[model samples]
Structures are given as C-alpha cells and as structure tokens.
Target chain A: MARPDQIRFRRSTLGEDVYEALKGLVLEHSLSPGDRINIDALAREFAVSPTPIREALARLEADGLVRKRPLVGYTVSPLLTRAEFDAMFEMRSLLECTSARWAAERADAAHREAVSAEAATTVAPQEDDPDGWHAAFTALDARFHDLVAEASGNGLLRDGIDRLHAHLHLHRRYFPYAQASATVEEHRRIAAAIQAADPDGAEAAMREHLARARERHLAAFD
Target chain B: MARPDQIRFRRSTLGEDVYEALKGLVLEHSLSPGDRINIDALAREFAVSPTPIREALARLEADGLVRKRPLVGYTVSPLLTRAEFDAMFEMRSLLECTSARWAAERADAAHREAVSAEAATTVAPQEDDPDGWHAAFTALDARFHDLVAEASGNGLLRDGIDRLHAHLHLHRRYFPYAQASATVEEHRRIAAAIQAADPDGAEAAMREHLARARERHLAAFD
Candidate 1:
C-alpha cells in the first residue's frame, strides 16, 4: 500500500481527488445504490485524513448521488423509478431541444463539422461490439449535446444541462447496446439539423429522439 | 459557546450536518459570492472539528454554491452574468412550465385550493413592499412549485428543480422590486390556470410569467 502522506501530497487538491475517486466508485457500481459508505475507511483508503473524504461525500450527497441519514451516515441514492425516469427524460427533452434550437441558430461551419465527425465515429463496422460502441457513442453523445450547449452561448443553461447529463449517467450502464445504436442514429439526425441551421427542425428531431429514448428506458423497467 | 464534544456527539453524520449549515450560509448570504471561507474558521464557528467543515465545503463546491481555489481555500460562487442569467431563466421557464403542466394534469381540489390561497396571500395592499412581499411570496412560490413537483410524482425531478431554485435565490435578491404588483398579478393568473386544471393554459401562463421575470431581472443589470 502507498504511504498515506505520500498519497495525500500527490493529490492536486484533496477535495477534487476525493470527488473523482468517489464518483468513479458510483459509476462503476462498486458502490451500488443505497450502499452505506464508511467515512473512516474511505479516508484511510485515499491516504488522506477524514476531512477531504467528508467534503467529497458532502458534494455527492447534495448532487443526489448520495443520501444522508441524520445520524446513520451516507448511502448511495437509489435507482430512479419509472416515473422519475420519465420526468428526467422529459426535462432532458426540453433542455436538449432548446439546445438544438440554439445550435441551429448559432453553430458555425466548424462547429457543424465537428459534430458531424463525432457522429461518424460511432458507426464502426463491428456490429456486435457493445463495449466499443458504448464507449464511442457515449463520448459522441456528450460532445453532440455539449456542442449544442456551447453554440447556444448560454453558460448557465449549459451548466444545468451538463449537471443533469452527469446524473443521468448513473443509469447508463443499464441501457442495452441496441438502444445505444438508436441513440447514435438520433445524434446523426440532430447534427444534420444543426448543420442545416434549421432551428425548428433541430428542436423537433431532438425532442423526437428524447421521446424515443424515454420509451425505450420505460420499456426496460417493464 | 457549545461544548466541542457535545456538538460532535450531537451529530456523527458530519457530512450532512456540514452540508445543511454551509447551504444555509450560502442561501442567507452570510457568505456572499466571492467571499472566501477558511475551513479552520468554519470548523471553529460550527463548534466542530475540521472534518465536517471540509466535508461540507466539498459538497457545496459541487453544487456550484462554493468554489475552491488551489491553495487559497473556498469562496462563495459569484453572481451570474447577463447571458448566464438569461440561460438560467430560460431553463427555469422550461422546467417550471412543465411543472405547471404536470400540476394541472394531476392536481386535486385540495391542491388547487392551496395554490389559489397561496396566490391570494400575495395580493396585499402594500404593492410597493418588496421585502414583505418577497418574504411571503418566496415561501408561497416554493410551496407552489413543491406542490407541482409532488404532483409530477418524480422524486428525482423534484430534487433537481429544488436545488436549482435554491441557487437561483442567490441572484434574485438583486432584482429590483418596482413591479411587485405586476409580479403578484402574474402569479394570480398562473394560479387560476392551474386551478382550472388547464395544462396548456397553465404552461402558457407560466412561460409568460417567467419571460417577464427574466426581463425584469435583466433590466436590473442595465
């Protein structure tokens, strides 16, 4: 094991290091939903004192990534219900549609080209490669949405949408590979609309995509 | 001052207690935007050790309520710029509109009555009393929105919207109160639409209300 002080000193910032580490744990499902986290153990594991760990936990708690029982300590927040899943997607549709509309209004040739390139990257020949497709598509999807947010020129909207996107990742692993391909196709359509600079078309395409995604996710629950 | 051990023993869930305390500081403007907070000082002030304070700061930082400088320590996040403010309101308009739509779809007689009564409370004789109206209206606004979220039956959406609402209060205080009566009137219209269970009407009314609110807020920056 690495020396405690060595690890602590090596970290650029105690809070950030702890945050990245814990967020990884949640994403990987090493810490499943509703799992209680022991602060002392986490502190020792990270080779820091309890302070940074506590700080990291507090951040995660507020993000709804974790839940705190007044005296019992922190637990990973539970998986979203069908209703929650629908509502979240409804929100995503609204934001993403708005983003697409703005992107159409604001995207330059370079931004349009960049989004197209991202979409093309997702269409590899390996038809059954779920992992490769998932990894590639995830980055592309993020880039696509980010490009829209950036083009929208709305920092606060971008920030809020980005945060929602992050929390949505909590359930990403549960999505089947087939569903991901459909998302890739949707991205292509959205990018095309932006490239065409048709704000109404882009908004419609993005909303349709989200509606489809919501239906697929709800089906999985059933 | 409270006993150190007494405070520590009063809450072993350091992260949660710290999050609540720090959140209060941010919302109440006890820690204004860009104001630096020393962890050690916070620890002392809370009558707890550095562990909880550090933890709480981490959480606040994540929520965008506080920001950490590499070596300087944490500070309250600054106010949003005009573009950022516009984006926030645009998104708020979208979400709150959706919330109102959902409320209309699901609101019972009791819920409708509650919303009507809350709106009625804001129609005071002192139309110029921003502070008093703010105090009353803010709580009513919260309850109105909370009820909408509850009606939506999505815990995740409710949580996410509530957090955004809290952060928004940070900037709302700066908005001038010259049009307090107009604001109250807008709320009344929104309440009436919701009471009528007209989802489309409620949504349209909310959009108008938010758009007007955004204009009012933006005018302040001029």
Candidate 2:
C-alpha cells in the first residue's frame, strides 16, 4: 500500500489515479493487450467506489488506450502490428524532421549548446551494458527532440508531437535489443546536422534514422 | 430543449454528459474564449452532482480547452494572439504541404475525381456573400485536405492532422473577411495540382496558399 502522504502529494483525482494505475499495468505488460480488465476487482483493490473506475475506463476508451464491448466491458488495446508500428514511426519522422528543421532556423545559442551537450553524453561506447546505454540514449533523444519543438515556437505542434511520442513509447520498450550502436550513431548525426544549422540535412538524417529504427524493430518481430 | 430521446440517449454518466456539453459550447463559440465558466451554475443547470462536473472540468483542463486556476476555478482558454496564430499556420502549412505531396503520389482515380468535384463546387464566384462563401469554401477545403490525409494511408498522420485542424478551426472563424476570394482561387489551383498527380506542384501550391492565408489573417489583426 502507498503511504497516505504519497497519495495526497500525487494530487490526482480518483479517476485519474485509476487511469494511471491501469495504464502502468498495460505499459509493463502485466496487463497484456486484449486482456479484459476486471472492473469490480479493480474497484475493490483501490478501495474506491466503482463510479470513478467506470469514468476512468471510459476516458481511456476515448484515448484509444482501451476498448469497450457492448456488454462485456473494457479491455486493453492491442499491441501495434508491424504495419501500424511502421506508420507510427513514419508519422514521428515527419513531425520530428520538421521540428528539427525549424529548430535549426530558430534555436538560440544556449539552446543549441545544451542540446549538443546532451547528445555528447550519449556518444561514449557501452557495448557491455546495452540496457543502461539504451536508457541514456532514449532520455537524450527525447530531450533533443523536445528542445527542437520548443525552439520551433509552436505550442500546438509541440503538444501534438509530444502526445504522439508518448503513445509510441509504449511499443518502443519491446525493441531494446536491436542495434543500440547504430541507434546511437544516428542520434549523433541528427545532433550534428542541427548544430550545423543544416535544416535539410537534419530532416534527412532524422528521417533515415527513424526508417532504420522501424526496420530494425520489425525485423525483431519476424 | 433537446428531444427526450436525445436526452435519454445522452444519459450515460454525468461527467460524460458535462464533457460533451462543455465541448459543444466551446466549439460553437457560445462560451467564447476567455469566458469564465461557473462550475456551480453549470452543475445546477445539468442537475448533477458537483463531483462529475469537477471530473469533466479536469478532463477539459487536460485537453487544453479550459484553463484552471489554483483557487479561481476554470475558464475557457483564450484565443491565440497574432504571432501564435501565425506560428500555428506555419506548422499547418508544412504538414498540409507534405500531405498534399503524399496524396499526389498515392491518390487513385476515384479520390482525384472526388477532390476535383469539391474544388469545382468551391471555385464559382460567391464573392458578394463572404460569410456563405466562407462556410461553403471551408467545408470543401476540409474535404480536400482530409482526402489527402486519407490517401496518405497513414492512420497516425491522419489523426494528428485532424486534431490540429480542429484546434486551428477555433480561431479560423475570426478570419472570414481576409481575401476569402483569392483563397478560393488558390484552393482551385491546389486541387488541379493534385488531380494531375503533380507532387511538387501540389506541395508548392499549398505552400503559397498557406503563406497567403497567414499574411491575410495577420493583416486583419493589425
């Protein structure tokens, strides 16, 4: 059981708390895709009434995170098929490439330097420690792209791009074993292109990197 | 008053009902940007408990459609200023141009014919009636771009584009008087480019059209 203070500090509503708990289960694969969620059990475990649980489930349904049957209630949304995964990467590449291009044109000296430093932190070889290296690279990669979105000076675009990235991250954890070195090299090239203020080069580099990543992920499934 | 059937059909949970109702109010501009939303009165009007209203408000807060103060409660989000609006259009121009390029590459004969028909409907002079012309042109314009997104065969891209279009439309109602005729002509050219399957031409046409639209919208603010 969570401490009372911890729960209070989270400042989440009952519905939101329920949603996050359920989403965590899905993300960790403890609640596998297409598995029906037992709402009654969840309500009992959470020490909350069923109404908030139902509301949370409906909200998740709206988000495409869960699906509901007419009489059977909700289940976790399925894992992305290979084609859907590719489509997701393609969308990400398009938006992120544009974001990087805009950032190259708009980023201030401080922002560019910070991004470069973050990228540098991920460049050292960690061949013996794939998981640690992957975690570091993922954090740096997200920060770099987020910085680009902020530099683009479009809140709406940034919000949309961020949401898509979050949704994609759920599926990304499964492919941690695929070509970490090449992934790091691609990130280095993307950072270098942005630092050079080469918008077209940055766009091309990011697109190629995402395309390669998608291929690698799909290859693992096969 | 809405029909009894409509009301009955809507009776799922109080939170869902309040959410749909508030979204309608915002989309219709009945609750204009920056207008204060009184939660107590809304709860009373809906004849539901305050908990559901609070939950619905929280969701709206997450969606960026409403602003919540620490103690002052909620209000409708404000309209974007001229600069913010221009930035949004810049992003839209990029995404839409890419969509047009993809559409030109992928659109079949049937899709091309449908877009061409919509474009034709939009091009004839309705110059004397700016409001009616704007409405007609806007609907046709939405169909043209939506078709392009659909033809791209990327569901993620289509969903992102649709959401951006919706958020952008909230401010579009303010731009009714700005070179609406020239805008229609530009759409006609873009449609022709798509019909001819000219990828570069379609992209260029969309870029020019969006640039002009941005200028006109900003000029109106000045």
Candidate 3:
C-alpha cells in the first residue's frame, strides 16, 4: 500500500493524467479563463503527441471547463458573469435544496453517518495556509456536496448537480475564503436537518447556505 | 434556402454525422438496449476509420445514451429498471416543475406564443402513421419541453433537464402511446398555466403530468 503522500497511478492512463494536469492549471489560474488552447503547443509542452491532449481537451469540453469552436479550435471557458452567478445559485437552490429534502427523506443510516463524519472532519482553510487550504477546502466542499447529492437517490439529478458544481468551482477559484466559518456552520445545520429527517428544514437550510455562498462570490466582484 | 426535407451538411463533420446516425439508430431501436457496440464493425459500416466512430461513441457516452467499459468496449446503455424510472421521474418532477414555474414567471410573449403554437398544432399520432407520428410527436414534445426550459433562463439547469429527457426518450420508444390525448391535454394545460403567468399552477400541472406519464410507463411493465 502506498503512503498517504505517495503519488500513484494504478492504471497510468496518459489521457486521464493529462486531463487532470490541464484541469489543475485551469483551477490554479495558470491557464486563465478565455485563453485559447493551442493543441500542438500543449502537446509540445507536455512532451507528447497531440492525441492525448486532444482527448483531454475533449473530456474537459464535456465537463464545461473548455469550449470548442467549429474551425477556431478550443479555448478555456470564460468566467461566469454576475448574472450567470445569480442563475447558477437559482439553479442550485432548486436542485441542491431538493437534494437535501430527498436526503432527509431517503438517506439510510450509512448515508447519515457518512455525511456526519465529513461535517465533523472538515475544517475551514486558514488565511496563512493558502495553497494547503485551497486543496483541503476544495476536497471537503466537493465531498460534502456530493454526499448530499448522492443521498438524493436520483442518479440523473445527482449527475446534473455534480456537473453544475464542477463548473461553479472554476469561478470559485477566483475568490478567497471570506466566509469560511459561516460556511462550516451552514453545512452543520444542513447535515443536522437531514439527520433529524426534517425534509423541509433540510431544503430550507440548503437554500440558505447556497444563497449565502452566492453573496460571498458576488462580493468578490465588488 | 434549403427545403426542410433536404439533407444539409455544410461543414461535413464526419464525427457529428456519425453521432447523429448512431443516435438515430438507438432511438429507432435498430440498436437495441444492452447490445455491445463493436467499434471496428461500426467503422466498417460507416466506411470510415475508427477515429470518428470513437469520437461519436465518446459523445454518446457523455450523453448517457451509451456506456463504455475498459476492456469490453462500448455498448448500448441497459434499460432503466422500475426503480430508476421512478427516480428519473422524481428528478424530472423537480426539474421540469421548476422550469414550468420559471417559464410562467419569466417567459416573454414570444416564448408564450412558441409553446402555445406547439400545444395547439401538435395532434395525436394516427394508427396508420406510427413512424410519422413518432417523428412529429418527438419533435413537438422536445420543442415544447425545451421552450419551457429555455424560458427558465438558467442554461445549466436547462441543459441538465434536456439530457434527462433525452435518456427518457430511449425508454419511451418501447411503450406504445396509450394516452396520447391525455399527453396533449396535459401539454395544453401546462401551456395555459405559463401563458397565464401562474407559477404555482404551472408547477402543479407539470408535476401532475409527469406523475401520469410515470404511471403510463409503469403500466408498460405489467
């Protein structure tokens, strides 16, 4: 077994690795939004041919992190505008709030335990530990939301939420942790609602959380 | 201007053509559920190399119409089970109901006219015109639903609902239209709700319609 810090590629799929690497660059803002991606240039930079890069780009395009034009090739997706951010949260309020409600109604003991465990373990990223905090926060945020979506017991709905969350993360990278403590508290309340099997409470809590989150992101522009 | 019946491929993108052709096969039941898709055979059938075929499969996989395995290759996605169908409808109820509500609140006069026109013009498929009916009904059904989603003004949510409806259509091909009149009537009621700007009414109408649709599909299994 590899150690926790050890990097392992069990399958060593080049295309997948390239996809991750490219996604990292995007998330880290090295490959900035709306930047045109030159396939041949990326191939040369990665010291491989164009095939893997193209495959990676295709997957990224499907993920909504990249866009492809008919004759113009691919470019990094543009950052979300204020209106888009509002639209995103409205959609999230509809989907994730419903997810929370369903989780309250449908989550089994195992699901409750899993969500509670995550809520207990996750900590707010500190100001000084920017890189480490970013990584920790991203993982925790994804897990917390993903578990709620999974507990909804609707695979298709869960998938849609997951995709939207992925695109949201791209915009999220621009903002710092202004309301981390509030976020943690909100997650606890959401989890508690679900654990208590209060469907309406869970839905309301989730909506409140997302509304606050939207405010936090909106404040970034101001 | 080209006629509606005319075939037009201005760009002649082979991958897109293959994707549409393959999707048509799946919709028409020429490519049945759970059937393994041989890439080489598809390449031969299309008289093209493996690249475009692989691309088409990748897109289809993203669309949830097809599945890909590591060593086993591609296959038509298996039929949705009873539980999945129920779950799918539950998710759709959440999404499309929200869409209907938003369409009521947000849709402009043009959107209202488009939906009203579809509801008014679309007739139940005749007994002797199964194929023509299928094609016409499919187009009108998709357009009606899509117009509502578009009116929601949330591209992400609209895309999610669109994808789910696509998968639902795959299952819908198997069941004969037992209540096409009910469907048309339901559509009219939904349209009327939106046109009247009654958000709650629209949402309720959509949910009721989906519930009835679910019952119809469930009856198919018996």
The model with the greatest DockQ is 1
CA lDDT of A81 in candidate 1? 63
lDDT of 2 at B165: 66
> How should the candidates be ordered by DockQ, best one leading?
1, 3, 2
RMSD of each: 5.5, 5.3, 3.6
lDDT per residue (tens digit) for residues A1-222 in model 2: 666754445455666778788766665566777788888988999999877787677656655677766456779888788778877777788788888787677777777776666666654457898656655666566776777777666777787677666566456355455466677678778778888888888788888988887777676565
User: Considering every candidate listed, which one attains the maximal TM-score?
Assistant: 3
For model 3, how does the per-residue alpha-carbon lDDT over B1-222 read when each residue is reduced to its tens digit? 777885675574777789899988987778988999999999999999887787677678778899877556889998888888887888889889999999999989999878888888766557897877877777777888998898777887788788888788567464447677788899999999999999999999999999988887777676
Q: What does candidate 1's lDDT look like per residue over A108-219, in tens digits?
A: 8887888777766654635777656556656567777887777776665677677777667666365566667788788889889888999999999999988887777666
- Under CAPRI classification, how is model 2 graded? acceptable
TM-score of chain B of 3: 0.90
Task: Compare candidates 1 and 2 on lDDT and give the better one.
Answer: 1
Report, for every candidate in turn, its global Cα lDDT versus the true structure.
Answer: 0.75, 0.73, 0.83
RMSD (CA, Å), candidate 2 to true, equals 5.3
* Residue pair clashes in candidate 2: none
Q: What is the DockQ of each candidate?
A: 0.52, 0.30, 0.43
